[model samples]
Target: MPQQVRGVIARSKGAPVEIATVNIPDPGPGEVVVDIAACGVCHTDLTYRDGGINDEFPFLLGHEASGIVESVGEGVTSVAVGDFVVLNWRAVCGQCRACKRGRPQYCFDTHNAAQKMTLEDGTELTPALGIGAFADKTLVHAGQCTKVDPSADPAVVGLLGCGVMAGLGAAVNTGNVSRGDTVAVIGCGGVGDAAIMGARLAGAVKIIAIDRDDKKLEWAKDLGATHTINGGQVDAVEAVQELTGGFGADVVIDAVGRPETWKQAFYARDLAGTVVLVGVPTPDMTLEMPLIDFFSRGGSLKSSWYGDCLPERDFPMLVDLYQQGRLPLEKFVTERIKIDEVEAAFHRMHAGEVLRSVVVL
Candidate 1:
């Protein structure tokens, strides 16, 4: 039987999302139904609402989420009903080349629910990041649910599903930040601050945070930044160089994703240093720079996709760290909001007022 539940959806491009009746079909052979406990309001959801992601109108918004397995399809064995889990977009297919090479994190053929979730009128909805979790319940491939400690707050651990994971992975995984490394993160939003935390966890001795917003910079400091640079008042690249003994940082991460910020990240790194791009850029955005610069400055320039994370391995470990008070995951949840207040949360996010506004169901 199909269940009807209230969900937030963007019915058309560039329009406000609304609560609508959504239909969730029973899990198929490899699917499970999750009863959402909380979902974070991410910038990507707003992008979907604004038609920035694609022409996938009627998108079911919200992706960063934590929930419980309410039911499972016949073939499901990894999780049982009532298991606390963090929802992830990546459901690696073991047969894919990436998975076969033991790099399931880069799996090319991720899985989603075989059945389509529809609106009350039977119109199919495009789930955000393949895990539309802004509702009472959502259908997902069984592999999408990564079990974590049930004691942790859903609002906090849920963040590991997306932005938080992206930022942390950007520094730890992509940038290969290590002990005694000097790291600079450009952008002090949730993602940037998460990168700071990751760098700290990786034993970075000097962590410099750069941002235009003073408030977000303060937040970055709380998350373990050794110094903060006001990018609006100072040249970010020069500031980073000055802070790192006039040599720049070993790892520079651009969380802003704009070409200007990316260039700043490139120029703000020591010679042969790594630069990680974790911020997402719009499709129409373009960059033009001297080809020689890329050759002369020899180091890794990597784009971190979902923090290059494997949710199965990372989520549980992060949750354990959070439980032990080693990771300040709770700090990311700036506010708890109802699902209906998501639109306002988007405005707050755009205004740089909150780190994250989570919808607590």
Candidate 2:
């Protein structure tokens, strides 16, 4: 029998999400049911509500989550029932071309639960990022369940499921930040702060954080940034250059994703330096820059998907780090609220009042 649980859903475009009864069916083959303990409020959820991701209405709008595997279906061998895990959107199908080529992080085909969770009237809902988790329970592919240290706080470690992982992966995996390198991150939201922490973990000598909000900038400093720049008050590129001895930084990450911020990252990196774009942009947005600049940049310009992370490899390590006090995961959780407060959390996120307003079940 399907279980009926309360879930937050975007029933229509640009409409506020509401708590409704979601019917989660028993797991099918290769799937597992998770009893979510905590789910973080991410900007993507807000985007889903605004019709930014797609026209897919009635989206199950949460993904950054931590939970325990309640049960497993046939052929699910990787994780068993009762395992503490973090849910990830990308469940790489090992046979995909990218996976076969040893770059599973770029897997073209990812998996979700074969079964659909529905409304009482049987309206099938699209899971946001393929792991709709803003509820008491969620169903996902076995591969989406990445086990982590159960001793860690669910509310803190759950953040590694999305925004935090993306930022860290952008700096470590994509940008290849190295020890003693000078780094700068533009935008100090959850993602940006994670990038700062990643750069610090990679042994960066100087990590400059750029953001328009002083509150966010202060938060960035606590996350390992060596310098902070208020972009709204000063020229971002110039500040980054001056801080990096006029040669610019070795790696400049754009966590804001807008074309303007991307441009700042472009001009803020030293020659032969890398630029990693971790921010998500809308389809209608376009980039316009001098063709000559692209050629003269003399380095790689890359966009990261889910921070180019292989959850199985990164999640446990991050959780362990958090447990050891090397990574301050708790700093990301600004507040904890019930499932029904997701809409209010979204508003607070938009107003830049919180790094993350997590839903604690």
Candidate 3:
């Protein structure tokens, strides 16, 4: 029998998301049904609601989710019912060319459940990032469920499902911050703060955080920034270089994807230093940096997709670290809300009042 659960849905573009009763089908082959414990209200969810991602109308909005495995469909073996898991958007398809080259982090073919969840009246619903989870339960591809330490608080651990992982991976995986390295992160949003934490964890000697908001800069300090540069008050690149012994940071991460911020990161990196772009940019955006500057910058210009994460190999280890207090995951959860509060949470986000407003089921 199908089950009806309360979920938030964006009925159409630019429309406010509303709580509704959604029908969840039985898991299909290689799929799983998750009893979601908590789901974070991320920017992507708001983007989906605004139709910024696509015209996938009536989108089921919630992706940064953690839950307990309620059941698995045929051929599912990586996890079992009752397993505690963090849901990931990218369910790596092993046969993709990237996987064949052993770079599964860039796996071209990711997956989602074949069957669709629906509104109570039978309208097909598109799950946000293929893992709509701002509900009591959700359906996803079996591979999307990454098992983690059950001892860790699910509310905090679930955040790693998206923004946190993307930011941390932006620094450690794509930016490749190392011991004694100088790092700079542009934007003090959740992702930027995570990059600062990653730099700290990697033993960076100086971590400069640049943002326009003073509250966010304070949040960045708590996360591990050695220094803060208010972009609104000064030239971000100049301040960053001044903090790093008059030389720019070895790795500069642009957490704000606008072309202007990208230029800031590009110029604020030392010669041969890497620039990691984890920020999502709009299609209207374009860059006009000189060809000579591109040639002069001798290091990698990389984009981190889902933080170059391999869920099976990473989520569990991070959860264990969180359980041991090595990672301050709890600090990221600014408030716990119900599924119905997603719209209000978006308001809070727009006002820049909180780090994360998570929906606790």
Cα lDDT for residue 285, model 1?
A: 87
Give all candidates' CA lDDT scores: 0.95, 0.94, 0.92
> What lDDT tens digits, residue by residue, belong to model 2 across residues 1-361?
6799989999999899999999999999999999999999999999999998899888998999999999999999999999999999889999989999999999999998988899999999999998999999999999999999888899999999999999999999999999999999999999999999999999999999999999999999999999999999999999999997889999999999999999999999999899999998877789898899989879889998989999999999999998999989899999999999999999999999999999999
> 1-361, model 3: which lDDT tens digit per residue?
6899998999999898898999999998999999999999999999998889999799999999999999899999989999999999889899989999999999898999999999989999999999999989999999999998887888899999999999998998888899999999999998999999889988998899999999999999999998999999999999988887677889999999999999999999998899999999999998886899989779889999988888888788878878888888788999999878889999999888989999999
lDDT of 1 at 340: 97
- Which residue runs does candidate 3 get wrong by more than 4 Å? none
Which 10-residue window of candidate 1 scores lowest in summed lDDT?
239-248
Off by over 4 Å in 2: none
lDDT per residue for candidate 1 within 211-285, as digits (tens), equals 989999999999999999999999999898888888889999999999999999999999999999999998888
